[model samples]
Target chain A: MTSQTKAEQTGAAGWTRRRFIITLGAASAAAAGLTALPGGAAWSAEDAKTVEEEIKRLMGGKELADGAKIISMDLPQIAENGNTVPLEVSVESPMTEADHVTTVHIVADGNPRPGVASFHFSPLSGRAQASTRMRLAKTQNVIAIAEMSDGKAYMTKAEVKVTIGGCGG
Target chain B: MAKPKPRIRAPKKASKGEVIEIKTLISHPMESGQRKDRKTGEIIPRKIINAFTCTYNGQEVFKADFHPAISANPYMSFFVKVKESGEFEFTWVDDDGTTYSKKSKLTVN
Candidate 1:
């Protein structure tokens, strides 16, 4: 028997199998839409926190110094692919027990989430240098802040032009 | 999702007080929860390795807190000063409470 006839024969309370399937699909779709609406709103709320705010949150009102001389950030001037952009950050420090880098926080300005990664280093690290790969949502400035164990912080930023966004754009 | 495989590169032997580079990479999707399915238009939930740590002989050497901005197949390289002969333990923690670890021994001259 044809599926249409089967569905008609199986009808109960004026609800055909075809109508039930369609209603089920619609209900799921509505449920998905409902979930996505709140999720998207939450993401935007997160994105509203700019890079500066993020840095301030991380620094906890500490004074941020210009790190042009001490912190070296190596990134591409223009990223052809935002999926994987190479980044290298090194801070000039003695790596001694008395003076060393405690953490290096990375933030991107234009991404949905500004917080990227934070690298914590100890004296055993020998050097406050690290390299990693990150995703860029668009053309924006990537900032690096190095917090020293001596209650000092250094900040530096670099701009990267991206041809294509990586955050599922 | 497939199981994430952790990979590490470290020198088996090093001179005392010598600074050595350690590289680590792990296979993961790093879903940012920002993407939507093309057909279903449903949002994909985020799942990523949120933390990585390296310890030498029970001493913390290096650690990193990751976010969704980290790309797929997370890769990181850092420096460590080898003071004594000991084993290095590396751990990667996922968002789902899964932890992947690897150990390597380094002999310091």
Candidate 2:
């Protein structure tokens, strides 16, 4: 009985060691492919841009005014699914040639990438309103920034609790 | 993969200078390049619709730039003011330099 138990224990240990080696080999192979593949460079480059960097790239150092009165966002307080979270943004603006919302940018703080979408509007867009669905990696804040034709920007943010992460899938 | 299909919804008739809502959806995987293949454990390269535009009678009305964070099968809704009966052209540009477009006519009364 003692011999049999020892043999079983050794078999289990050997199985674990084999799994560890296989995992290490796979990880190294993936790392090598990430650098050696043709499109891999671009993929890593895109992954390097953080949320703050992306936001700066969009805003270009412009002052963001408080949008509490002008901008309104409709988003779920708790998203059951992070893969598809509904988002709606609207700005109080009279769609006119002289004064209108030129662009509305959506950015998620906890997404793999910050930028969600940027909507460009014109006077023909009678209302400064838009709705779309986005993916959230985790529980994070969703920010909406509206750039007006008059060269001013309005910004607002809301937090959304996510039950499951969307990026891993 | 099947060809990405474009779908749009807009009112067929509207009063002059009336505001109307338009919704558009396109079928695309929007592969974020972050997910790994279950069997191969290999990362899937990203391929998504990057830009969408709506033009009324040749004048650009609404445009959007999309990133990977956009869900698969992108859907967008916006507003437009109709001044006259004309065709609204909706275009979706993919990351692979392919453009898919659809047109819808609106009659202004």
Candidate 3:
């Protein structure tokens, strides 16, 4: 009788409880195996959106943190070389034992992964600072995000002007 | 690939409210493993500066993970606000577990 009720609940989603359990087992099996299917041949604007969703899902599906006061991004007004354009991000946070910046992610809009890199931090980090030179295929906005220990999120971004093609188009 | 010579350049000293800039560069080819060798006809293995970390007096100042997409001789510069004089150590790690490191001392003025 109890199993019948569980089956009824699963039936709402058009899945039998027993079938659902089997599907879960198969998913775990797939997760442990080298079963990644090759995706599309090329990246498009839709791919960019999907990548954004994937990264956000990696972050627990939280909305992007974007604001002006807490986070800031610095980039060259005009990139002399798309191969190595300087980028920096800093958060105005007092890195203390009780409060500190947790992580920062640099994502270029047009890149394949978009999420180029991420930095995890602790109170040991005296201040919130990170800088790196990045490769941009074309003019695009570089997004910088920061998560704080206090459960607050902040973001900043800047557009880079890419003049020459670096990928040898 | 050759062992990269890393540069660890930092300020001589720092005081409260002073922002100390740190500069670093490593001689690396930063191959993305996507291209084939001109002669060998085999794909050049992807090797890159995967991670960079900085610690101040046993505390971390900043850290970053790089990708093959980064340019050769990755040059990075960032500033840290000085609260007290301490030692700053920088470490760079490549994809093959090879680690290159350098350190400098900061004296509070």
| Chain B TM, per prediction | 0.98, 0.97, 0.92
DockQ of each: 0.49, 0.42, 0.20
Per-residue error for A91 in candidate 3, Å, reads 2.1
Best-to-worst DockQ order? 1, 2, 3
Put down candidate 1 lDDT per residue, A35-61, tens digits, no spaces: 122234243234335676787778777
Q: Which pairs clash in the backbone of model 2? A: none
Candidate RMSDs in Å, in order, are 10.0, 13.2, 12.7
Tens digit of per-residue lDDT, candidate 2, span B36-108: 6656655668888999999999999999999888999999999999999999999999989999999999999
Any runs in candidate 3 off by more than 4 Å, and if so which?
Answer: A1-50, A121-126, A167-169, B16-18, B36-43, B81-85
Worst lDDT 10-window in candidate 2 chain B: B34-43
- lDDT tens digits, residue span B1-109, model 1: 7899999999999999999999999999998876655555556678889999999999889999998889999999999999899999999999889999999999998
- Candidate 3 lDDT, tens digit per residue, B1-109? 5779898778796667686678898898876543334343334466778888888888777787775447778887766777788888889998789899888888887
Model 2: per-residue Cα lDDT over A51-97, one tens digit each: 67776888877899999789999999999988899999999999899
Docking class of 1: medium
TM-score value, chain A, candidate 3: 0.65
Lowest-lDDT window of 10 residues in candidate 2 chain A? Answer: A32-41
Which stretches of model 2 miss by more than 4 angstroms?
A1-41, A44-48
Q: What is the C-alpha lDDT of each candidate?
A: 0.85, 0.85, 0.68
